[model samples]
Target: MSQFDAQILVAAFELSYNDWTLGLRKSNMQVDVLLQNEVLRRGSSILEQTASSLSILPAENADIEGSNLSLRYDDGALLILGEMSYFDLEGLFVDTDSFYLTTGYRFGQWLPHITYARLNSTDDDIRRAPRIETIKNNLPAGSADQIAVATVQSLAPILWNQESTSYAIGVNYFFSPQVVGKLEAKMVTDRNGTISQFQNANTSGASAPVIPDDNRILIYGLSVDVVF
Candidate 1:
């Protein structure tokens, strides 16, 4: 079978509840609600598999509800934002949620921002079984021992009771009203970081290699944005 494909659509509603100024500072709050629906082609092959698959895949048809709020002070000089998103994949008996919070401070045309994000998934079994077929088909043909071990490693399913936290700090400079440049550094910390299933190196009743279970990753990025 071929790899799956997905089509997604999103709609949103927004409202500004308050916009006021006290003394020299300006403050406003706005909220938005979003709905997302997606359809997957050949989704069952990946989503309905037994604990035998090695990846956690999304269901063929899924729905997500999300909302976000933003509060601004002194025009864009200082701002705070919060967002929450929830997913319901009843077909696969899975549920997931995520949260994001951000705050920014501006000094003239230069802005510094900090953000935190977290993701939580329920139903670990549904989280770990979608990629076995792809891996099996992609393995090289000449290495028999390697392929055998790889197949066995992928056949075992791992639990998906995992949570991840990400932290980011960035500086943005507004070159003009229509253009901005940014540089950012981010780190992600994952608890129970196993995203793929693999067998243990020690068959003496020890667990699979725990080295990859918890991970901390650092990333740095630079980008420019232009509004036309």
Candidate 2:
């Protein structure tokens, strides 16, 4: 679901589920296209820097266009999914393209899944950090440049080119034909990568870029599904 409201002018829209499914000897394949928006909520940390001495940055809206192709084998015993998504930015630094691949296997009620994803910038100038030349051109004032620089200096989470892998183990319990509950624990590994950042030296017309740290996170979640 999505709504486009700019300057109090309101327009609403919803997406319908549409896909083409083909049945094979032992598997089913499906494909679909999606047009959506990744609406960045105001005050999101991705847009705002948390460094005590830096200024706050505003979040920008992104238009996402993507498609998904998936296959399921033996009534959900095994599954594979792949997707390619492109993000168009509004008043942000650069556009990005992403690719994702996922596979899952189910043994009785236990399901294990793994996913790989990569994000790359379309704007070559924004390899590690937003280009100062781009900033100066997009925002032509001294004040705007200062804010942009400060925003980068604050180390906001900007998705530069990076690759990550995640693994999850879960089980599904069916309460009825139309209802189910699922529990899963997932761990994600983010390798060392360079994201766009601002440096005080850059303010003085020098080059300064920041390299992000490698990290990992584990998440546990439970979810319920119901169908009418």
Candidate 3:
């Protein structure tokens, strides 16, 4: 329905990204700004329908507020097909995205296509702030701030999303006009933060500094064709 959303609540502190077309052999540009994170992806494919009729298409994309995983699939209209995803604002994340452009022609037992795209996602933080709850000193009363403490650093919600893409230049090969095969690849990343609300004019526990792990995955695939 809507291309871009102003504020993504159910998911906060997000990152955005972009991708390219399959048949597109040229470069392109995109404009978008996010507060926390960003991501980019690309991909491509080819198919032949007939001797005289052929289809070639190249595409690209951009994502915003991509702190976590972002999965969007559009059928023909939005340059996507189908997708599934999971995101978190509290821990490391794995995500991905993609776009495909197709042009096909009928040529007796042949159909072809050309596509292009790119992808990228990196290490992210799940916990943004550290916390400690204060308690009465039963052992030895220290400073007013160091009496009894409970850790609440992970109060921040974990956000998750993804980005991916692909592209094809010139030389290609395929068989069957119906269902031959398919190719695919995608990348994932995320960001972290802590949202704290005091309980009893309360205090919080000291949290260990969180270090994000690298989740940039590469996807490769093969495609098949069939004519019926």
Q: Which number leads on lDDT?
A: 1
Q: What is the lDDT of residue 18 in candidate 2?
A: 33
Per-residue accuracy of model 3 over 1-228 as CA lDDT, tens digit each? 013223332422322244322221112223122212111110011111111011011121222223222333323223332222222111222223333443333244333444444332332231221211112222234532222111111221222222334444221234543455445443323222211111112233433333234333234556555667
Looking at model 3, report the run of 10 residues with the lowest lDDT sum. Answer: 38-47
Ranking by lDDT: 1, 2, 3
All candidates' lDDT scores?
0.51, 0.44, 0.27
Clash tally for model 3: 109
- In order of appearance, the predictions have TM-scores of 0.55, 0.47, 0.24
Q: Please, what are the lDDT tens digits per residue for candidate 1 over residues 140-226?
A: 654553354343334322333446788999999999989999999988786455432222323455544333433776779999999
* Residue-level error in angstroms, candidate 3, position 14: 28
Could you tell me which residue pairs clash in candidate 2? 128-196, 129-196
Candidate maximizing TM-score: 1
For model 2, give the RMSD to the true fold.
Answer: 12.0
Whichever of 1 and 2 has more TM-score, that candidate is 1
